[model samples]
Target chain A: MNAVIYALFIVLPYVSLVVLIGGSTYRVLRWATTPKGGGGLYLGLYRLVNRAGQRSYLSAVGHILARMLAFHTIPKNSYGRDYGTWLSVFLFHWGVFLLIAFHLHLWMPWLRVGAEAMYVMGMATGTIALGAGLFLLARRVGLRRIYGLALNALDDYVAITWVVLIIALGLAMRALAPPGLFGEAVAWATGLSSLHPEPPPAFPLFYAHVLAVELFMIYLPFSKMAHPFTFPVNPVLYGKFEDVDEVRRRVEEELGW
Target chain B: MVSVRKVTYGRGGRDILEESPMYGEWRREFEGRGSVHVRIKEETDEGTLKAIGVTEMQRIDRGASPAERKRFFASRVAEMARENRAFRHHMDACVHCGLCIDKCPEYLGTRDPTNSPVGRADLVRRIYRRLNKASDGLLGRDVDDKDLARFLEEVDLDRIWTYYYQCTECRRCSVYCPMGIDQGEITRAVRQIFVEMGMIPEFNARTIRGVYETGNNMYIKKEAAQNVLDFVLDDMRQETGRDFKAAMDAERADALLLPSSTDFFSNIGTLKGEIAIMDELGLDWTLDSRALEVANFGLFEDEAHLKYIGDNYVNAALRRGVKMVVFGECGHGWRAFKNYVAPRLEAMGVQAISITQLTAWALRKGRLRVDKKVDAVVTYHDPCNLARAGDLIEEPRFVLRSVVKELRERVHNREKTLCCGAGGGLLTDELMPLRVWAGWPSVYDSLRTGAQYMVAPCSIDKAQFPAVIQYHKAPIKFKGVSDFVYAAMYGLDVDKIA
Candidate 1:
């Protein structure tokens, strides 16, 4: 059971990463290649990043990081009429980030000391996220206007069920599993050089959690969630003036003001 | 008391009048209600006087001859259907919801459907469609001399001309248009056709011709332009005593300040503010009096005129060897300078920047600082020529917010802003009332915000808004952003800033 869990962790994430990265890259490239005019202010990525002076570089990076962490594609002002949808979005994103951070402890040897604390925090956040996902799914199924802008019933069902499966399995593994099964599995996985092989009992919940999380990761970049990365490409930033007075003066002087 | 008069005609062969209404009433009052006056003028050359009176009465219709009428209608229709894609698109896009009707100053004040831009465009389109179809079916031609005459007679040609030309093409109607139809384009096309037909209002014609010949619409001579600047600067010195020089053609300056010629003559406050802002920012800016006309009416005329006015700016900038040029509060002037003039300059290998863009840059660079606590509720009116038509909306707002305390934004701002109804060269005396009416809705909208002041960075709007405010009884001061900036920075010491 320990060997199998370790193998699944390594295999699932790699497959998910490959699909998400590849699909998003293709979509973005296709959009870029399409011809459309009147787009306003076309500067390369380097120039765009360098804009607002060098001192703003760190702030710009912070802004981008905040967006990714918080799923900040939808503006606060726009969510005035639909706060619940936005709140659910916020919780789900926070849960995903926390869960990923907790999973990093499993992979990184240096973070092994706080593994138990990380696991508890991750499970608690995951439970709230699962609830939020289920709420959003209900909204999508019941409310026509809200659903019009969001995922359809099938998509909502898949997303909510996946999150629920992961949270349920995570909580079950910690609370309902046999007393020594989980500890034995962890010890066997961590102790690579120890010749004493301690194989723990197989739990169906662990496999279900792994599969659901893997499916979610692979679906992320291709889903509406991809809008998070496109925040920087907003036209307002590009069209805003760098120097108003100089341009005005030059025009006046040229026009024989 | 009501007075009534009765006339009785005999039942005989010719039925000679027993008493006419006027004669009978006078006779009854004078002769005890029983007798009538049988008076006649003494033999005093009746035939000669009668012939002279008839000729005098016929003179009124002298200009409305068959040839003149045909020419007028043919030219009007041709003008309405000029080869302008912008005009065509706007006409085609109108949804005709009539929301724009009440928004029109002329339509509201006079209650005349003919004055509405949408109505005017529809009238022209209907006639064009009808004439085209009829001619195609019967005569294998669109318009003929007789058809033109009849069309003119049917559609009050003179009134249509006056009503259509009265529009400033400020694009107030475009804001309410669901399809975003720029009625200004149609108005412009109409104006162009009128010009082609030699039917332009005398004042506009003179101004257009003046700009064509003298390079400035007002036709202020080069020497006069310098003198006006000198006079203003001398006044500034007297007022503040700090050698406020209106420097012209300063070599190798970082920025070239371009105020409209009117700023030097009449609108000195705008100039003073521009100078103050530059001084506060510690910018290396200089003024050029020679190319100082920011109100480019040439854009309203043909392309040749546009090029001619644009060249003046380009030539002046190149001659001065300045790095950048700044414009005063003139919307179409800036529109021409930024959109048309700058491209022309670039094509002619002249490098110059837009004024609004330069101001935004200065703010970003910390060259200019606004206290941001000079508390006054201010809202910006985006000059139509600059905002929707010219792609300059945000810069002015950004600049205004930087300088003012409480900057209240109009609900429909930026690209969706209403026009001030003084664009497209309709700022003459004849069109003043219509101009005020055109600007009434926007003025009212600004008032609704409960703003203490409304700021527009367009010279035409600045000049016209005062009248609009007065007419609407709106208790708000209208000023340019530069005026506020100048007052804040320079205070009473205009000379030090200049």
Candidate 2:
């Protein structure tokens, strides 16, 4: 049991961390080095900065952020049809947001709370994540309308299912299991953060959740979930608007204007 | 080489391309006539592309062996996908939410998944992914030549030709895409790759050849173009008792007007409107013999032709010493002029502006006077290139509303505009049925407004929309925006002219 806990809580976390960082960097660099027509990312930005007036660029940034974070670019007409999917996705994302906030209790002293209060918080966020994740999975698999969209790959299903399992295991450990495992779990989290692999608490559900999270981390960079990193780099939504005069000026300067 | 797959439907049956609701109605009268399918296939040794009059275009024999063609295809895709940040990002970023499926006219018209932006983009994206997997060593062993050849064989080249050519590169799908994946850009890139292999559509290739050989897409010689201008001006003299002399090859001019060669040949109403506007404004504008054309088919082809044709006009402008270049009402021509040509010419200290912009400016300054409002119910069709690609959306409307009584709006207008069927060199005679079907959305939208006249400020729309309206049996007269503007002008009263 101790050996299993050590592998899941300590060694596996570090392995996942290394792969997450290295794989993501490699993915970014692979795309960055590819030769493209027109000016590269920076030149596109430079043109945007030149073409859009000062006010328009700032507003354009605001518009890009709305689209990236809020899925603002989804067609307005599709709202009535796909609102449930949108809502489930939002709930899942917000649940992840709260989960990240909850995890900070491992390091920050002020972030900690009473055991019962933590239990309530965990139940609330966990339920949202689990429910939303299941809804998304069901819609992707069961809904014939969405099923016809053609771009749904196998990884989409795998990625969502993996995260949902992690959420389910977490809720089970926190709300249904005996309430004595919280302190030891935090200690293990702090010890791992401090680069010391502590023997995790003798709670099977806790280890199960942690193991699932570690696997998810390793899988993150390989899937479309890597969109969080690459989305900002996309030229379509974020690139400079075309202004003939501004581009001409830049071209002229290159021609010794 | 690409060949069409012929589909014969029973009378009152669904068209196999798209499960179109009207396909049943379209076939109601068809006892023997069947539509040719736009689906793509690979060229076999026994059957080749049955394209006619395309010998003038360049053709490349990529190599004798299948392995060689496979290597060429893979390496070219990798090179292009790697170098272009937009291409790389767009290729990687599609989440396949399917938001862009219904937004595409080709997909809506054909109901073929391959015609959708995401589906078309994936055809090219899969090649990029295959090359990425091989080079990145995702597989334990590097992808060998045999595997690459097998992969290449699986990739139907004729399908790539049919679908990619079928796309108009309108960029409408990019507007509603959650990730901003411009699949039109991918289509253009794929088309450019095919051009590298010396595979080009006969329509685009022949038009490009004409531009090089005769300085225009329609092969209008200098004398022929000059004579057309003379005849139009002479008609203008008889109608309005106004001597309209368009300066040609002038030593120096304040503005140089570049109308599409189509305007000189077929779109005489638009050409005459341009003459009236320029005459009324009384600007020091010249229509030079060297730079008489504004249409750039290179935009439909690859970058080399784009540069060649772009430089041709720049050289003409330099030779004539014009300070400003005015692009007459044309869609892709204005895109090439505003986005591509204008910037390069700006460095040479010449200003490139659209005729719509000039008209808007003239209207604002009260330089060009209107006698009376046009007594017609009109709705505007926003050309995709002008609205989505270029930012000339409001100028045309502002000019039109000043002359016309009521300017009705289509269901999808401005940046969200649907493409006219005959764009990106899909304007050939053979694609007439496909063009008419693809144009159903805009034509249907116009009919919903109950407008008598469909006004569009584009040469392509002028040439294409009339056919679409006639085929759809829609009760709308297709006219250029400037045609109404000319009718509402002081000299040519709206009630006096045809």
Candidate 3:
């Protein structure tokens, strides 16, 4: 029974993550390959990257890092009166970052002592983050403009459900489970290289938490979260200058301006 | 190449007056006469407009508005808004921050916030929003005739006209706008509104009428255009004398050169240099005497006029059988040809390239040579139309730096470059003071570089720069790229360099 539970917890989540990431990458590649006229896409991309490169490399890297840490790319002022929704977004993003760092400890050998302390901090932050995210979900449903702009069937529900489930299971495994069970299970799994030690039978909530997180990662890049990967390029492309008159004149004089 | 025969007219419908010297002179002779109609025909040999006899008399009601005038005028706005997403988006997205205050030439020059593009756009937006709300919700009860009248009165028609006309529809403000609100689109829309209100500027009105009457905006007869070319070439010979020729309607030419009519009448130095540069480069280029204009006033009006002006260029190109067509350095003209005309032509099955793009191509192809040593510390001015509307910011800098030596580029160059105060057809007697005021910011910005000379590859800037520099008492000389290139290549033996 314990062996079955452990397989379901770790193996299922790993499979789901691989499938989601691989599938989304394929789709993005396909979309990029679609043929278009006028070289707008290529030129746009070149202009954007080149402009960003024109700025000192240190400045570009610093900007990107600051945005990642603070979510500074999103404007702070909402057109509508919804302070709670904004706060919820802020809390949730910060919490997600902390939680991801805590999870990485399981894979990173050097972070064992620090990871334990971080896990406790992350759990505390994650609880508040989960609550804030729930508040956002409720606000989206209540607010007409937000509901209209933000809510689509697959996006709104699939994302919300995944986040809520992960939070609930994580909380259960951390607070309600027998003392030392969570850490012991992680240790046992890490030590047993080939044996694949079974999860403690009583820690079923831990299995559910792992599964939820894996599902979330799979869906992330395909949805609105993908903005992180794309939005930074806009300013760079828009900043470059291409003098059409000079280009037109050269073309006229040489090829036919 | 094209010829027009002068036919005279009298007060009576068919009575002949006297034979005139030229068709344009004949047309002028009959101006304010009872009525005169020009008969235009295309000459096969030269592929130019051949004139038949002119007829006169029978004055129709000069002030009569078109049938369904209100609906017609309303529909024009509706159509323009419907087609131009940029115009609609800019109008809708305005936050009224008044940040565009410094960016507007009129407002910066005059220190009047009301003249800024954002302020003008806000007026339009408020009116549009009010109309929309009233029509949709209150069943038109929310807005009454009295309220409409009051709104109209508060709009400051003269100030609006002055400021809107003052804008060259350059997109400098749009560059800094957080919402991507193009002031050009806003100004164009405002101009349309003025046309509806029967408040068109006199000079602009005349130019539009000229475009309608003659194919070109200046109303230059084919003979007169040819004569002007001859006059300029003779002047060039006296000045530089290297056998410079202004080829008109030459068959199978590599390029169709469209010099602004203003360049011919004024700024003859720039014109001479442009011709000389082309000659020095050994390029196969020709000018068209029949359609000797790059400035298209139709951009300020309805699509019909836009199409009409664009068709003239396309027709000229097709008739001459040129491989490519190049426009002169006029801001709105470059914008019209590149952003509006070229795309429209492609849609109409007449594909052509823009002058700037062609020039950049030539540089890339090594057909044109530039000595960077000759051009040092050169700073470029971004004509708003080309910078914002046409998305042309870098090619000029590249071309200039490639030719001139030790070019020190301005930091706020390209998209952030300031506009010369004389855009938007505002360089008239009435707007002279306003032009000086509006041009102050640009003067300050350019003067910071302490460069000896400023290079603007725009014909309007070339015309406006002297007055602006003179008004401000700034010690900076303005030169077009062609002038600089020509001057740099003056004594360099082409064979030895090659």
**Best candidate per lDDT, number?**
2
State which candidate has the highest DockQ. 2
Quote the lDDT for B152 in model 1.
61
The global Cα lDDT (0 to 1) of model 2 is 0.70
iRMSD, per candidate, in listed order: 20.4, 8.7, 18.9
Give all candidate RMSDs, comma-separated.
Answer: 21.4, 6.2, 17.5
Leading candidate by TM-score = 2
Query: What proportion of the true contacts does each candidate reproduce?
Result: 0.00, 0.36, 0.01
Model 3 spans with C-alpha error above 4 angstroms: A1-257, B1-84, B134-163, B235-241, B281-283, B344-351, B354-360, B370-377, B492-498
Ranking by DockQ: 2, 3, 1
Count backbone clashes in candidate 3.
Answer: 44
The sequence of per-residue lDDT tens digits that candidate 2 reaches over residues A18-59 is 988988887788766665465532211122121122224456
Model 2's DockQ score: 0.32
Task: Put down candidate 3 lDDT per residue, A47-68, tens digits, no spaces.
Answer: 2221212334556556555545
Cα RMSD for candidate 1?
A: 21.4
- Provide per-model DockQ scores: 0.01, 0.32, 0.03
Per residue, candidate 3 scores C-alpha lDDT tens digits across B1-498 of 011111112132221112111324323432333111211111112111112000111122214453333333333444444444434344334433333544555544443444566665654555554443412222345456565555544444344454456566666665544334567666766675554444445555566555555656678777887787788777656655567866877876766778777666765655765676566557688987767778776576433345567678888887777655667667767666754456544554443554444455567767676543363466678776666555555666766666666455654566566678777666566655555555655655566677767777787787677777786577777767655555555533211211
Error of 3 at B395 (Å): 2.8
Per-residue lDDT, model 2, residue B381, is 91
Against the correct fold, how does model 3 do in TM-score? 0.58
Output the lDDT of residue B266, model 1: 55
